[model samples]
Target: MTPQNTAGPLPPPTERRRLRQSRSLTHAQLAAQVGVGPSTLRAWESGRLVPHGSEGETYTRLLTTFAAEGVTAVDGPTAGEGASAVEAGRETPQAVVPQPLTPAQAFDELYAFCAPALVRQNYLLTGRPEVAREAVERAFQLAWQRWPEVARDRDPGGWVRAAAHDCALSHWHGFRSRYRRPEPPPADPADRALLDALLTLPPVYRRTLVLYDGVGLDLPETAAETEASTPAAANRLAYAREALAAQVPALAEPGELRRRLRPPATSEEVRAADPEPVRRKAERRNVFWTWAAVACTVTIIGATALAVRSAPTHYEAPIAPAQAVQGVPPAGVMGPLSREERALQAKLRSAAAKGPYRLVPEAR
Candidate 1:
């Protein structure tokens, strides 16, 4: 097969470390690019720790680029020869093409890498194991639904973290009976006290503390993720620290507080769902919403068409109202006759024999 055909997406952790070696780049050189210490990057490659936050994102991107360029593993004489060439003032090792991965492979790798820590962090946010699991799973589902956007994002892990945190802390949970009851506190008194103190702070303060302290994110990164100004994020962090210190005296010092803010031992109770199910669920939900929109559009069109068909086509003139007739005599019973009428009646009787007493019409 051709080198381009063999090239793949980001490799597993071991392969990534080997790929770096194949490129003859030292830990210090790569750590500088990732904005972290060499020891941290070493831990990441050794599988003793997983990189996260902005640093993890940078690392993921760097590895992705390396994969896209088809970096290949080199060992023994090949490695020594590359080092010799470098000592001889060569710019870079000879490039070797490698196999590439599909988008699904990359997504699965990202999910496996981020989900466990996210679940633990979300549990810290909500204090409920079930809710934490639900939040992480839901966030993954959303990420899958918008996979292209997430894959193109600078920090896909952070994107998922924000969604999970928002879901965990949503006020809507209060209305559901399933979530109304509180979870049991940690068995250790100190852990329980710390959790209570954390929960007592406002959600904004709580989130700031978790991002800045619990997740080991720098102030600027925390601020950017929280969508707040640097000063606002600082103030919230300070307020959260003060509240936590007031309740848990052992954590009064910043160093001690940061140490204590690591995922609590009890967080093992929260387990994230597998990535396959989340992806399937996301696809189904997208399809359902698409059909729902289509149905609504069809209903609206039918109603509009019916209205147009039944409406009046032309106008008709209205009739005029009734009025009283003029010059009409009021009729009921008749009154006495006038004198002229009586005189005319007498003349008629006196002049009766004129011509068989023809009756003449008289005005009365």
Candidate 2:
């Protein structure tokens, strides 16, 4: 396995890449073996489909299996077992790579899962934990905006990581900007005093402490995510826990900090509100249907106009004399005016003459 190398909030792509590479099959082959389509395999490999909670473990297993067998399920030995099989077959069997994926290619799949967390990671680092979020977000977007350059690199994750460090450094350089979002002092007199004391701690230590203790990443995981060497990750995790425990009373409570990191109920579901491609297509269909409706309406209107123009004029029938003069006396509601207006207002005149004439105002 690769040494712990990152401490960013996003899940470490490095570890995933190592796991993916350990296998010896292409992505398409793995998908076939796993009963998934080539596109599905690509999505999983590219890290576009992020699994929540147990899904992470499941992905690890799935990807590992695929890497070993290809998408087609013609299987053999598992990791350690496969190595042993190789040793045994050395005498006669030719060395064959059944499954293989490159580190850069694997990381490409991983970026999406951790993309959003780029912001969260920054927020956790630096004493101005509030701004850490913006820094990470900006860093990730900037990296993404330059993806072509990133893709060209052999270690794209490493490249993006270097970019993240540059972003963090810029934040440090612009310390004055941090003051704009002045941090609220702790309310308690003792705690406030301790909080002030915390500011004097070294920047590196503070970052390590906040991530390992403030956030709930286990030391190794934190180290790997943060890009720290294994020993460094462990040391930072220990020191941060100790420092925070010493300063905050609740933090000293058994598992208090850990509980704080995650609420009691954590469903293994990511609230990915982004619509799937299928949904987008459905929306497009609705738009096309709307246009089709307008076109049909225009067609019907045109047909009606054409029929009216084409049809021969003919006098079919006339209303009976008594029925035409039914109730109203021809003046309209305004009462009779002249013979020209009155001739058309015969019904209105009749209604007006009847007196009650309670006309409701129109709603327009």
Candidate 3:
């Protein structure tokens, strides 16, 4: 694949370093990108050692892939069904944005900032207690891939809420679309008259109502996250309220609606639970490093023992203490002296000038 325009960061120093930078990248998105820890990344940024090998290569691909996410065409269907017009020429693209933090750092920051709010929004929107959990999981998964973009925004929780809502809607749409079914409309007489009409309203109207009143996200923050103009967002929300009121009878009782939107109480243990993304990533890294440390320790100890065992070792007979030298073993006790042994023993003794030497060698 063509490398992403790494030429933007640090002046495209060299192809080798460019390649290394690519591998070192992480986005504020999906959790899969955080193979290394933040400390490691800091070390890399401060001109310490660069990450190398296949892992580095993976990082590089991520960097380049998003370099110009002109990844997919940014167009939609137009009124003219047969229009084939296309741009004949283009001006040079603007300087790339400051390279965002690697995906891991963004994930940690963004998830913490957004997840709680998204969970609340999920409960409010869907009216199902379990959906809040799934909504948070899926939202951050999408945000994990775009962590840099999400974290850089003024209100990350709002961004997260939109992504989470989309993920949940996509999930539901996929399920319903495949089944070729829609839920039976609300049954209460007031809802039967009004809620059915609300469902008939446009998507923009329904979504605006869900987000503004149902999920309790403010228009300005919601507009930023959803990429809607302020006037449009405000107007759509207004229209949505009218439609929802005109459509659903259950919506008439605001207190009842609020209670229905509330999530069921979870046990303290569950309430205190870590996000699945963070927990799972931590667990995976912890398990890997724990085994790695153990394996390395075991290997070093084993190697040292092996080296000690294989080393050349000569067992020297203990010298007799001067006072204890009264009795000594005879020379012929071990074996008859060979001429070479005699010569070596004589040489050794002559050097020390010991008297009446009767040296015996130990078994080889």
Candidate 4:
């Protein structure tokens, strides 16, 4: 049977299976042709998954090509019969399978797809093409060294973008910007004005603005890459937009600024890219310093508490009544006593008579 037209809605799973059968191609064969895993093709045929983004478009194009080519199944017994024959010790003609791309090949493809856009993103951040080129090159070089880890990442491009951003913000760039002459303005008046306005903003605001508007990252992603909280990123984006609008009224139009600032390439369009490099080293150092400071603080506090708890306390001994009165004269004085003293002696005699009295000889 002839293949269905691809201009209409996507063919159902049954139709895909029929088309594959008509072409005498196994699931693995078709998947290899399309540069996807055999399981992915099986999922598409089973209706368990639907391709999206570039994958979906690729599927449509492949299906269209398959229909146009009018490939037909070779004359042969059913697959079950062939398998049974093989089990019975009968040899079946083997089909040559396409080899999968190696890791190096995959890395090359990924770098080719993502490097240009990443370079553009860095350029926007640093306002210098040379700095941007160096940053992107450094990031890709690191990715090449850690290809396995980077290949497994879901958003490898994001990792590379963050690394390049850090490189652009490195201290060397600051020194260079201070000592070197500023680059000439662009020929376009609007472009020149926008660049000038962006340069005037604080680094945090500028980075937030470029990441959100120019790089097409969502608020949370921008915040993560910038190492800011979501709320803080939102605030920065709002302030940056307002500042840009004030300076360039044309930017006040919704999406106009984003359109003007956004790079020609997108992360979605380029599914593969490099890994993060310098950020990991910086993060490790930061973690070590933080733990060291915490340990020192806890040690000091514990020592202070132990010292206070184990400190010695002083107490005074109680004095005997006789010793307390040793410096005073006897109750009966030789010389005339003051009126108040005589009254005190009379009160003391009364108390002494009521209780047991003790007498001590007067000193010579």
Candidate 5:
């Protein structure tokens, strides 16, 4: 089925009226089927307003149902389809036509269509089915919360797919997975080996490979989503491809690798997957990291300030040269002694004369 473009405005009133008439149903009946008031239906028919959200979805589905059932009004002809009755010169009932799908319906259809592929991509990236399911669920929940932005996006599927991949690589995965039971490994030996090889690669390399090779994203796109430079992404892809070829030579071909890594289940099977707990956990982790960073910054600043405040200051002073001792003569000196030195020598001699043994001077 062709993917519906949900970003445009509603269909014209004349188109809506023609479809309703072709169904041979009154405006009130059609409105009831579409879960709207008769007046609302009239407004749509008169071009005063248009259906949006779920109402627009209802109109699309109801008209599609009519066209599939071949329901036609007793009128002459329907819209878009040529007037066959006029050519045949016969009066035949007008047939109802399909209306456009609304953004909400289109989003639902996109989720159902892309979820399985996204899950598989995540699974291949992380080597864990449970983690992949968690990732898909979280990505979808975020898409639902931001449907307006997502619907208008150029590649909504790529956006969600990238998000799912990130969720699979979240830092809290280890803590979150502990409480859950482990899923069984893939039955295929080649797949198992491929997954093992993929798991062994660094997260960036693995993600780049998956987005580029597995998901068929171009180098620039992969780089943009992975937040890496284009050159870096290309290098990573080359390394991952070479490593995978070396590890699992049997599945060296890109097509074979994608086939082996494709998701096994449909999105409907895991539609009930819960993402609230995971989202909450991620929020908590972010809060904790923020506070931790703040605490570290404050501690560094405080330590620097304390060190500057407590350091001691020092000053230098000059020292005078040592003075000669009063009774000691200068080394190697034959000159006469100074007045003070002579007086000291006479006192020493007087003391010596009074003692029993006089002191004798030794000549050098």
Candidate 6:
């Protein structure tokens, strides 16, 4: 359920910016804390939009904390005309209007917003910083490859997170020599123990625990991200928590368990590459594969055409094999002639030399 607003009306846009600056928080950091996109927070600070509902309450509370810390703007209205307007209880009816962003611009914003935390989460998922970096880069590459679908997604960050998690936990990595052996353990004993426990859990359970506890995703969101039923996800989370607590007794409490599920200090080494290079590499790969497919198709077509051109047009019968018979003489053997054949030959020889005469009547 959404919590009620106890922080009262928010100060004007200018004062909110001043308060945030005084606390030395980046837009990303503050937005993360307030459960909003950096762009939304920027809108709040610029007065193009106003915070309301649960988000408004959270923003007001955070600003109140800053104000309580003795950060104040001298020229801006703290309790002046701007505060009076807010106090007058006038609610702005305008929704958050997203500015038009080109594909490149939108992609860059998403990368900037999600990359750092993705690296950290992937590192926690896989104990190796190098592997974490590789998974995140690969995931972003895939995202760029399918940017049209990903950009249209309702939860783009969640989509990227799921991709990275799957990459990190892939069994295919076992075949590669680099990922065969385990990486070195974390330096601190507690971190090492926590990591060891996390690594021991089944991949699905580990992923569920991380999404729910480490990343602060609610049960339903965690289930949706992990592609599991809500009850199944809840059960996995329970089992994972029990196993982790067994390994590290200090993490018995739910709060403590969530706290310890962070990336170890070694995560400092895990850094994602610039988004520009990842996008470029994805495009290059897509182009290479496309040309390769076209070349294969052309080669097949040429081979088929050549075969048809050279093929014989008619069929010829094959000769039967020679067979041997007992009555037949062997090859190249001859038999003597019969007496009747010899007599006929002698008669023809004796009647030669024009001995037979024919009578013909002469014409008158």
**Residue by residue across 1-364, what tens digits does model 5's lDDT show?**
4334253444566766777766545553465456555556777689676566666677766666655566444554575344666667676564466687776576666665677667777777776667778778778777866778977775677778778888989878777656256656667676677778988899989898877656555577679889999999988988888898998897678767655544352222333243445345545666787899999999999999999998867765669889866987668868989999999999997888788686667799
Cα misplacement distance, residue 11 of candidate 4 (Å):
8.4
Query: Looking at model 5, how many pairs of residues clash?
Result: 1
lDDT of 4 by residue, 61-149 (tens): 77767676664444556888978887887766665554666876665655665677677666566666677777877776667666678
> Tens digit of lDDT per residue, candidate 3, span 132-189?
5676776666565556686566445556667677765554544554335444433345
Ranked by lDDT, the better of candidates 1 and 4 is 1
The C-alpha TM-scores of every prediction are: 0.65, 0.34, 0.35, 0.50, 0.48, 0.65
The most accurate candidate by lDDT is: 6
Clashes of each: 10, 37, 19, 0, 1, 0
Over 4 Å off in model 4, which ranges?
1-98, 177-179, 265-364
Off by over 4 Å in 6: 1-3, 10-99, 262-267, 314-364
Which tens-of-lDDT digit does each residue in 126-195 have in candidate 2?
Answer: 3344454445444445544455575566445435544554465464546575456666654446444434
Prediction 4 TM-score vs. true? 0.50
Q: What is the lDDT of residue 173 in candidate 3?
A: 45
Candidate 6, residues 258-319, lDDT tens digits: the string is: 66654332434667889899889999999999999999999999999999999989997999
lDDT of 5 at 280: 56
User: What residue runs in model 2 are displaced by over 4 Å at the alpha carbon?
Assistant: 1-112, 127-130, 152-162, 169-181, 184-201, 209-233, 252-364
Against the true structure, candidate 2 reaches a TM-score of 0.34
